[model samples]
Target: MKKTLLALLFGSSLVLAACGDNASDEASDANNPQDAAESAAGTEIEPEKIVNQKCSSCHGGDLSGGMGPALKNIGSQLSEDEILSVIQNGKGAMPKNIIEGDEAEAVAEWLAEKK
Candidate 1:
């Protein structure tokens, strides 16, 4: 029983460590900003920031999907690059040229593989 409990605790710790890493990654993604000029120059921007600045306006708070489609599981449905392109270029009622350069990339990353 002692060994079994130890193993369980160890496994739980590993899971927690992984979760922490993912959380950190998410936080890092959010804090990082997209350099519009840099993106135009070929550098990509972080995704979370883009969602906060540009997407929250229409996509509902926290990507709940208001004027736009819900993005909970978008990442599973579409590739990161595809989402980035669509946001950058815009489609239909989305209007073109809303998000520029790295901002587009950031928003795409946030939306990609959501859920």
Candidate 2:
């Protein structure tokens, strides 16, 4: 009877240990911003960085316009969807697909907030 009790206690301990590990993993995942953003509902692409890397060449570092028209207050001129379309499809003098996928959406979202 003592041996049986010991075995049961050992099994219970192992189960609890496994559960604790899972909980710890979940907590760590929750703490990670990228993981949380990816796991949650919306995409979390960084638009300002994208602009600096890609659009800054044409739009200017300050987005006040260079080769391309000033993007400042572009939100007032175009809706979010329109901005996304332009980024994906491109406008005159702007190359098509200058940005794509989540990057395009991120840029559009960022530009939309410029108003």
Candidate 3:
């Protein structure tokens, strides 16, 4: 019983770790500059930064593929609008609205250029 409990705890930790996003925590803090910047329009959202921070875990650091499918050439398969839809609505293991509003648009635009 003890061993089973330990195994469950370890598995749970891995799952939680994979889903963790420190940037989201910072963005939620009202006092943080990131929150303010994100709220404003035409803020020059950095899509690459968002991808590295928000997507690298699942899509792989280089986006060659990992737990998620290879997105390096996603534009070859999906248009900018389609990509945005997936980001907004999610597909398969991917969750919806990982980043919302202008930030989501920026990332979708950037990824669409990947092809």
Candidate 4:
């Protein structure tokens, strides 16, 4: 299920990128995962550091749950896209944009692998 969703998103992104003005650049980006990710977010980010610095305090030092919900198995409950949305938009008592841009994308992708 996770693979299927990731493949779908990846395929969709490639298609969208291909539809842009610079087809050569887009096509190359489609063939390069690192490039695609960087373009999608702006730059490469260290998610673990971000999580430790920003999320550990609220979610628990071990991420087992503290002021916020347990994130140990967050991917079982939310997809990367859904997690990104929550990170960007906030939920319940969570505030928006605790992290933004590439940092947020990196964190979402990492957390979505917990399952």
- Tens-digit lDDT track for model 2 on 1-115? 9999999997776445322344665687688977766747566678898788677767789999986899999999999999999887778867667678887887898899898
**By lDDT, who's the top model here?**
3
Backbone clashes in candidate 2 total: 0
Clashing residue pairs for model 4 = none
- Position 87, candidate 4: lDDT: 91
What would the per-residue lDDT of candidate 3 be over residues 45-74, giving only the tens digit for each residue? Answer: 789988887888778899999878989999
User: When superposed on Cα atoms, how far off is each prediction in RMSD?
Assistant: 14.3, 20.3, 3.6, 15.5
Ranking by TM-score: 3, 4, 2, 1
Instruction: Write model 4 residue lDDT over 1-115, tens digit each, in one string.
Output: 9999999997776444323335676898999988998888756578987788677766887789876899999999999999999999988867787778777898999999999
Query: How would the candidate models be sorted by lDDT, starting from the highest?
Result: 3, 4, 2, 1
Would you give me the overall lDDT of model 1? 0.65
lDDT of 3 at 47: 93
Screening candidate 2 with a backbone cut-off below 3 angstroms (N, C-alpha, C), the clashing residue pairs are none
**Candidate 3 clashing pairs, residues 3+ apart or interchain:** none
lDDT of 2 at 76: 92
Lowest-sum lDDT 10-residue window in model 1: 14-23
lDDT of each: 0.65, 0.78, 0.83, 0.81
Q: lDDT score, residue 61, model 1?
A: 64
Whole-model lDDT, candidate 2?
0.78
